[model samples]
Target: RVKETATHKAGAYATVTVPAGSTATYTVTVSSGGTSATGSGSYTAGTTINIYAGSRSGYTFTGWTSSDVTITNASSKNASFTMPAKNVTVTANWSYSSGGGGSSTNATLSDTKVEFDKNEVDDLKVTLKSGSYNLRSIKNGSYTLREGKDYTISGKTVTIKASYLDSLKEGKHSLTFDMSGGTDPVLTIIVSDTTKTDPQEEKPSVEDPVNFEDVKSSDWFYDAVNYIYKAGLMVGTSDTTFSPYTDTIRGMIVAILHRLEGSPKADIANGFTDVGSDKYYTKAVAWASENRIVSGYGNDIFGAEDSITREQLAAILMNYAQYKGYDVSMRADLSKFADGESISPWAKDAISWANAEGLIQGSGSQLMPTGNAQRSQVAAILQRFIETITK
Candidate 1:
């Protein structure tokens, strides 16, 4: 039996017996086109449970919904709601992104401090993305530093000159950069005094994504690095460095591809003396070898550390496409390129397959097939590869 208590009555109260809690089950399921994730909950009725919507690379979570109307509020991709009256199963829907770049209008660098002495001819770099040029101004209460005369901008990297530092007195300094296409930077440069002996390194109160010494926003592959890193496909050699210009190894590419394929089981034995199951790249090598995506150098040896050429990347990616049942047809004329004949015999078909799909644009007039790809170049190509497959 239930009883109505107070209806907007002040100081009025009524005693009643609350119903016992019932166990409710919730399950999360995806139809397709999403990284597989597990979501299950068993909670008492009327309890609030949070449902987090997750997505894979190149995909976005739409929302969550269930058939039963008993479950109210079918909105919010990541939200909490009351337990339904009965068993409920929620479906996660996903949609692909257009794979384009987005720049911030008000993006600003986090506040930071630096220690430098006068007469020290050195460079102090600050992280920035491509967009705005022409520094508006630099102010620090009593003094200011001019852009072209005091500092220089190279891509997304900002280098403050020692000539400017020599002019400033020792103390805390705050500078505001007025950027056009990019976000303004809110950085603090600490001019170390001539007094004392050693100066401690300045640290950020919180970690910033753009703090990588080598990765500035102005670089062409900046967005791609963030995309791939966040998607769990790649990582930096260190927290402070991405080494975007470093040459990538063949084994590394195989491992990245395997991760993109959801790290499937290694159905076939990978016959490579150089790569053992104990190594981290072992599973990736196995998957690549089983699917004919890549083969070792020769004599049961996989040159895991050898530099991977541009043509090799093309071939492996093409093989991956075919393995995934994607069409690898070609209709483009490769003979038009000046260095077409330089392509290796075995890699011709793969290169042709990729080029016809508008995936591999030649370097100037040359195909540069044998040339190795830089880390930055790999990120750009990988981004395009995912975009192409999704389309």
Candidate 2:
């Protein structure tokens, strides 16, 4: 026999008991035009879970619907809901659009999973598809990440700091990036044990190798130097030394670009008196001047021996991109950099475009627009330009 007392009153509080060991399963499905939806898992009752919707090619994400639970922000590509005591499923809707969405666009992350060695200090770089978007928030479960402290943004790339990754325990973790104008992406981070040896490091491959004594495999610009060297875009100062730290001269830069252009003969002579006809860079200067890729310093003289500044290099590359009919419309907001105001007015657009395209990654919080670019730095910039822009 059971005895209980019940009172019926307005605004009365009632307590409900969920059975021990009970779990709720969350599942997500998509409509005909949709591809896949994330955020399906088993969780305890009353746990809030994030759901992100994805659309197939030639389709755009519309909205979401749930028959059993109330979804928060159903119209957004990323949404959330509290898990009920019973199993529930959410459905993502999509529509077809044949026309291209121009500047107003949706973006996707380049990768869904990333790995980090506990002892390594390399930041986790996550790239996004071509679009203009702002990051709203980054969440690891219920915890919110603070920018600059946890991560930094450059163009469409989000770099999670190594300090933050090192703090995480050695295991798998998930982070959700909520951004505007696109699907909010989730990243799975696998933190590896520092004590364990990586077998790949035992015998490194030497294909298309650069045997410069100064350029080590551990250097940050190693691959870039190797790439430019093997491609015949740049060569070492000596057979033994690459002089990676040496400042690059204007003539050298033009010569490299001329080599990239197949070293075509100039139809007319360049009007610069300083560039001699017998010099190695004379044809390059002539070709560059004829193509309008560069304009020598104001007084009918090309300072061929002068060290090229960061802004000048950016402008030259921008001019080259324009000549090649590549898109130069994308521009990044340079206000984040401390020295943004220092960029020359003439090179403003070029620097902005280069920053947005990841061609000129500035020193921490400083663009250093007036600083001279070094040989290794130029090699890295050329590598980025070729891999991203030309490809």
Candidate 3:
């Protein structure tokens, strides 16, 4: 018999390796203070074996197994026995420590799971199909949009709830999506009114002499003249010459406005010494000053005879739009016009807004904004204004 010695205080483990083709029974013994206990396992050659503590005064056994075995003398004071043919290696592990308490050797396992639910109604989408031009004009009732309706997204098989749908005039509109606190992409959609007539192509009727013979008789001025005329905003001179090529003067323009407003009589004393009470445009000039439409040229002199320029016309139109409760600020962009820097400071915003909103187009790339505004240009401006409000 081969002999090996293993010493453990209590609650410990001892491992023993036996040689192949070895047969024997092995025993493990533990002692603490004066108490002791023993356990044994039997195995044949070519097998491994292990022995564990059975019972003792103050001890336990953990993780011990037997596959090969050996026998040894079990009658010695703290003496360990071993088998020579097994040539086994034995290891003793102690659990009882000097100060730290004991702990379990079992391991813990962990796992996680994920789940999802399918939704029936996925999204809602909205689009502006038309009326982009009128919508931007800041004019009321000229353009309308559909309201309080529902639409669906077809390709994705998703149901959309549209609280409102607006009927805008024919044009390109943008589509947008609302995704429950998430970002929704945008798409462009076209809305059209196939039945609408082309106002530009409509000829001036020969029977309506008062409407057709004005300086705005040509088709180019038709829309502008009609709109201003229908609104009672502008009128022609006594000679019936709309004077499409003639330059508009400051005093004449004011008189036209006074007439458009029903020629409201002025009670205040004339502020300009140069304008006499008997002058043809006296009432109009005085009223214009009172209404903040026209200011003096300099030193209280109202240059009523000077021709109005393109820039000046733009300023007046924009101001009129504002007075009518339209917000022209959105179109403000002075830099777009080459002559923007030359415009009067007071008229800058109004002119820029008019140009940007397509209400007034520049003469070529350069705006020639400071140049005299002829009757034809004025007619065009008026036509665009009328079309905007009517649409």
Candidate maximizing TM-score: 2
- What lDDT tens digits, residue by residue, belong to model 2 across residues 211-263? 89999999999988988887889999999889999999999999999998789
Predicted candidate 3 versus true structure: per-residue lDDT over 68-162, tens digit per residue: 33333222223244443443433332343213334422211121111111122223333322211111111222211212223443433323232
RMSD of each: 21.2, 22.4, 30.8
Model 1 TM-score? 0.46
Worst lDDT run of 10 residues, candidate 3, spans 108-117
* Model 3, residue 141: C-alpha shift (Å): 19
Task: Compute the lDDT of residue 203 as modeled in candidate 1.
Answer: 18
Question: Which ranges in model 1 have alpha carbons more than 4 Å from their true place?
Answer: 1-210
**How many backbone overlaps does candidate 1 show?**
4
Highest-scoring model, lDDT: 2
Once model 2 is optimally superposed onto the true structure by TM-score, how far is the C-alpha of residue 233 displaced, in angstroms? 0.4
Could you tell me every candidate's TM-score relative to the true structure?
0.46, 0.48, 0.42
lDDT order of candidates, top first: 2, 1, 3
